[model samples]
Target: MKILALNGSPRMKASSTYHILAPFLAGMKAAGAEVELIHIRRLNLEVCIGCYTCWARTPGVCIHDDSMADVLQKFNTADMVIFGTPLYHFSMSGIMKTFIDRLLPRFEPWLIPHPHVPGVTGHPERVQKPYKMFLVSPGGFPEFEHFDSLVATFKQMARMENWEYTGEILRPGAEPLSRRSLQNLFTGYYTLLRQAGEELIRDGRISDNLQLQLREDLFPGGKEVFYQLAEGYWTEQMDKFKVPQEQRHTVPLLAKDLDSTPMAPAGSNITNDTSKTGDRYYVSNEVIMQTMTAMYDTKAAPNLQATIQFQIIPPKIDFDPGEAMWYLEINGARCDLHQGKTAIPTLSITTPYEVWYDIGIGNVDALEAFTNGDYEATGSQKLLNDMLHLFPRPEPGSDDPLAAELDTLMMGMPTAFNPEAAKGTNAVIQFILSGKGGGLYFLNIAEGKCTVQRGAAKNPTMTIHCPAETWLAISTGKLDGHQAFMQEKYRVSGDMAILLKFNTMFDTHTN
Candidate 1:
C-alpha cells in the first residue's frame, strides 16, 4: 500500500499529531506499506479565492501556479490518504481547511447520481480511482465530544465525494508525550496506535477494540488532569508574556469572546470541567493491601503449601537491617502480614519509604520501580515474579466508583516516613525510574539523618535508574540486586562503590 500523510499541525515535527502518526508510520512500514509524510506548514499554501478559474479555464487542474500542484500530484497517486491535524475551534486547523478547499480542482463542478448505485447518491466527478481516507487528530482536552463536529464534517465530505472513510484516530490528553508523569499512559496509547496501523495495512481496517482504546484517556486522572495540565501550560506561557500575577488568571485573547458569549446550560451528557487546584492525589496503602488480599482469595493466587516469606524494610534507624522489618508470608492461598524481623526469610526488600508510598498510591509502576533500582529483592526470581502479580492495578483517572474511591483514598497526607535514616550519613542519591509508573526521587542524607524529596537531587554521590516492579522484587530479597545490575536491568552513575555501602548507611540488615 502507498500512503501519503498531510500533516496540518503548525508545530510540524514538534506537534502531538505528528508524534501520534510516527508510530503508525512505523507499523505501516512493518506491514510492507510505503509511507510518505509531508508537513503542510512547510509548504507555501495560499487560501482558496473561490476563483472558479480551475473549472472554467482549465479542466481537472488549478489555474493558480504554486505548491498546490505538487500536493495535488501526491494526492492523486496515493492508494490511501491520511489527513493529520490538531483540533482548532472544534474543527481542523485553518491550513487543513484550506487544503481541503484546494482539492476542488480534482472534482468537476457537476454532480450526478450514479446509475449502478442502489443508494442513488450524487457524486463528484473525478479522474483517479477511488481511494480510502483516514483521519488522525489529537486534542489537548480529555473529552472526545470536542471532536463531534470535526468528525461529522469528514463523514459528510466523504459521502459527497463518493470516497471511503476508512477510520479515524482521535485521541484526547495529547500532552502526555511531553510529561514525565504520564509516560506509562502514553506507552499504552502508542502501542495501540502501532497495532492499529498494522491491522489497517493487513486487514484493510482497524479493529473496533483498538479504535476504542485509541480514544481512551491517556492519563488515568481523566478530565481533571487534562485541564489541570492545560492550565499549567497556559500559566507557563503567561509567564513568558511577562504578565503580572494578578492578571495571570484572566481569559486568554482567543477565549475572551467565547467567555462573554451567552450559551445554554450544558446537556446531561456533557462532562463538566473540574480543573481546580489541590494536593496531588494517590491510592492509599490500606486500599492496596485490601485489594491484594482480595486477589489472594481468588484464583489469581497459587495454591502452594510451602511457605514463601518476604520482609519489607524502610531506610530508617528503627528499621535497622536485622531488628525491624515487616514480614508478609504466603502459604497456600492465604497471605499473612506481621511486624518485626523473620528469623529465616525467603526474600527481603529494602528502600526508602517514599518509594513504597508512590507504589501504593499507584503513582509508580512496580516494574519500573524495580528496573530503576528503587528497591531490591534478594530471593527466587520465579516466586518474586509470581508474587508481584498478586497486587491489582488501579485504573488511572477512571470514573468507576472503585477507581474514584482509590483516587481519593488518602486525599491529603504525607507518604514518606524516613526521618532518621540519614542520621550520621553524608550522601545524596537520586533514583530515576522509567517505563510505566516511574518518576524521579531524591534521597538526601546529611549528618546521619535522611530526607526524601520528589524530582532531582541537587548533587548526588550516586544515581540509579531501574524498573519499579523489579526494584520492589530486589528490595524484598525476591530478586538478586547484583544479578539484576549484571543483567543491565539498571544503570548507575557517580561512585558505583558507594552503592555497596547503602546497607550499612541505611541499616538494611539481612535476615
Candidate 2:
C-alpha cells in the first residue's frame, strides 16, 4: 500500500505534528505498506498564483518548478494522503495551505485527476482518495475549535477536487505527551494509516460504499451538520466558547520552491533584508543562486554539477578540502533543516543516483513515518540530517570526499586510528575523561597501539578513552564519527577546539 504524508510544520522533524504522525506511519510500515513523507516546509517550490491556468490554459501544468513538480507525480501514485500540521492562530499553517493551493494544477477544470498518458482509456479516477491526518498542537484545549477549522478547510478543498474525506485525529499538548501516551497513540494511528494505505494501494480509491460508511461513523452528524459547523459565521460565536489564550505564530514560508521562482533571474543576489536564521531558512537565495551561477558559468564541462560542503555549528561555519567551489553533480538530495526551528529530524537520503524521490514517492513522508513509528532511523536526528546533507552529488569525475587520493596510480592505504588526529603534541597527549566512570587511556602515536585502563592520572600523556566499547567500534568502522557523538558514545572535555583540530592531522580511518 502506498501512503503520502504531508507535514506542514517548518521546524522539520521537531514539530509536534511530526511526532504525532510518526507512529501511525510505523504501523503502516509494519503492516507491509509503503509510505512516503514530505515535509512541506522543506520543498523549494513556489506558491500557486491565483491564475486558474490549470483550469484554462496549461491543463495540468502549474508554471512553477520548485518542488511541487516533485510531489505531483507521487501524489498520483498513492491511494491515501495524510496531511499533518499544528493549528496556527486557529487555522492550518501557511506552509501547508500554500502547498494545497499549488496543487490546483494537479486537477483538471472539471476537477479530475490529470491524464497519466496521452490517449489511454481507463477509469476516470478521482483526483485523490480518502485519506487520514494527524495534527499536533502544542497545548491541550477541551473545545474542538482549532481542530475543526483545520479539518474543514482541508475537507472542503479535497471535496472540490473529488477526494473522499476519511478521518482525522487531533493530538493536543506537545510537551505534555508522555512516552506512554505516544506509544498508545501510535498503536492506533499506525493501524489506521496502514489500513488506509493498503486500501488505496490495492483498489485505487476506497469504494464509494465504504467511503460513505466511514464518513458517517466519523462525522456522525452527516454533511449538513458538517457544513453548518464549517461556516465561518460560526467562528464569531466560537470566540465566546472559552478556550486557552495561548498565542502561537505560524511559519512564514511554505514548501513552494525559491529556486523555481519565476522572478527576474534573482540576478545573482539573494539576501534577506532580515534573515530568519537557521537551516529551515537554509543557505538563502543568494548562496544557492551564487552556487548555481558559479556551477553554470565555470569553464568546466557543460554538464558538470557543482556542490559545496559546509560544516556549521554556529560561530563555527567551516568548509573543507579548501573553501573552493567544485563541479559536483547534485547526484542526490537530503533534507537538511540546516535551519529548522522545530525539533524535526532533518532528513538525509544518500545514494549515487542522479534523481531524487520525494516523500510522496513511496506514498509516505520519512519524518512523519518516523514520528508515527512507521519509519525507523538508526541514529540521532542531528546526526541523520548532517549525514544526509553530506550526500555527495559528486562532480562527474571528482574523487570521493571521504577518501583522499595520495598518488595518481594507487589509493592511499587507510588507517585504523591516528593519535595525531585525536591527540596533538600538547606536552605529549594530556588526555582526561572525568566524572561518573569516565577517564582516559593511552595509545601508541606511531605504531597504532592502545591499552585501555580505568584508574586516574594513569599517565596523562597520550590518552584516549570514550566508553571503551565506542573506542573499539571506532577502529572497526562499526561506529560513525557523527553518530558517535550523538549517541554519547563519544564526548570530550578540556580543549575541544584543539581536540577537533586533531581531526585534520590524524590519519584518516577507513574500512
Candidate 3:
C-alpha cells in the first residue's frame, strides 16, 4: 500500500502534530507500507481562484502551474492519504484549508446523489478509485471536545469524495509532546500510535479500543494545569528575550533564538558577619518579621495553639539602637505577627540580633546555635523542637551535603518502594537538586517496579526542584516533606497529586 502523508503545521518538524505523526508513519513503514511524508509549508502551492477552469476548460488539470500538480498526481495514485495538522481556531490550519481547496480538479462539476447518504447531494469523482482518509491532529487544549468540529468536517469530506474515513488520531494537551523536558512522559503514548499504524496497514482498520486509548489525556492535570504551563512558557520566552513592555504586542520573539543568548550569573545575598556594614549588610528587624511571616506553616500545627515571643538585641551600630521585640500568635491554621511581647507566652527566645539573623538566613544551624548558648530560651522544650518543623527554614545553609550522600539516598529508593502502593502507578518522577551536591536524577516506575537513572528523563510525570541539603534532610526524616513544600523550601512542577503519594509509596525510613 502506498500512503501520502501531508503535514500542515507551519512549525514543520518542531510541531506537536509531527511529534505524533512521525511515530504513526514509522509504524506504517515497519508494516511494509510505502509511506512518503511531505511538509505543506515547504510547498509553493497557489490558492484556488474559483475559475472552474479545471472542470470546463482543462478537465483534470488546474490553470495555475505550481507544486499542487505534483501533489495531485501523488494523491491520485496513493492508496491512502493522511492529513496531519495542528488545530487552529477549532478547525484545520489556513494552509491545510488552502491545500484542500486546490484539490477541486479531482472532482467533477456535475452534482449527483450522494452514494453514502440518502438525501445529500455531492459531486462525482473525476477518477474512480478506492482510498482511505485519516486525520492526525494535535491541539493545545486539554479537552477532546475542541477537536469535534474539525473531525466532523473531515468525516463529511470523506463521504463526499467517496472515500473510507479510516478513524483519526487526536491528542489533547499535546503541547508537551514537542517539549524536550516532557518527552519521556509520553513514551507509552508514542508506542500506542505506532501500534495503531501497523494495525491499520495489516488489518485494514484500527481497533476501536486503540483509537480510544489514543485520545487519552497527554497530561493528567487537565485544562487548568495545561493553561498555567503554556502561559508560563510564553512568559519565560518574553523574559528571556528582554522584550520591552511597550512593544510586547508588536514584537515577535522565538524561544529557540532567545535561548542562545548568555544568561546573567546568579548572585547570593547571604554574607559573613565580617562583611556587615551599617549602610550595606545589616539585617533589619522588619526583615526578620517578614521572613517569619513568610515561613510560618499553618498546616504543621493546625490543632495546637501557641504564642512565641522573640527578644532580639540589636547589634552595636551607630545607625540603629536598642532591642527589637516581636511575637507570633498561632491559632489552628492561622498565624499572625505582632510587634512587642505577648503576655503568657508559650515560648520565649532571647538572642543577639546578629546570631538570630545568621540562623534565619541559614548561615548557622539553629540547633547548633542553641546548643552553644548563643541564644537563651524559656519555654516548653517540645515547642522549641516543634518550632523548627512549624516554621521551616526557607533556604539551605552554607554547609550542604556531598553528592555521594545524595547518590546513596537515591540508590535505596527502589528497595524501599512499596509495590502495594504503586500497583497502578506508571510514571517517571524527576528530581532536579541544586547547590553543592546537586544533579539530575529520575525514577522510572512501572508495573510495581522502580528504577533509578542519573541523567535527564525525556519525559517525566512530575519534577521536583530543591537544594541538596533540603532533599537530604527530607530523605533522612529530619524534615517533613509536606511542611517543607508548604513553606516553599522546595518547588515542584507537573503532577502535584503524585507528590502527595510519596509517603505511602516509598519507605523513607529504610532508605
- What's each prediction's TM-score? 0.46, 0.35, 0.48
Show model 3 residue runs off by greater than 4 Å.
Answer: 244-511
On a 0 to 100 scale, what is the lDDT of residue 33 in model 1?
Answer: 96
Model 2 spans > 4 angstroms off: 110-143, 178-511
- Model 2 residue 220 CA deviation (Å) reads 28
lDDT of 3: 0.77
- State the local distance difference test value for candidate 1: 0.63
Best candidate (score: lDDT): 3
Model 2 lDDT tens row, 1-511: 6778888888668776776567656655666778899998889978778788766777777777678876988887786678877778767788988887787765555433334434333334325455443333432332455467777786765554456666565654343232343355344443454454445445544455544432222223544544553464347556644333331121111212112122121222212122222332222222322222221212222221222222212211222212121112222221221222221112222211101111211122334434443223331344333322232111111343221121111111224344545443442233222212222222233333333321222223332324333444453467775577666554443445544544454443312
> How would you encode candidate 1's per-residue C-alpha lDDT over 235-276 as one tens digit per residue?
986767663564333223233212222222223121212232
Q: Rate the local accuracy (lDDT) of all candidates.
A: 0.63, 0.43, 0.77
Global local distance difference test of model 2: 0.43
lDDT of 3 by residue, 1-511 (tens): 9999989999999999899889999999999999999999999989999999999999989999999999998999999999998999999999999999999999889988887777999888888899899999998788889999999999988887878999898887888899988898989999999999999999988998998888777767777777888999999877765635642321122222122122111331212233354332244665565455544665677675677778887675544533488877777676777777665566678776776765664456676667666777765556776777776653332244466778778867899899899889888887766545655567998999999875445567887766677888998888888888888788776788788777788998312
- Ranking of models by lDDT: 3, 1, 2
Query: What is the TM-score (0 to 1) of candidate 3?
Result: 0.48
Candidate 3 lDDT at 14 equals: 92
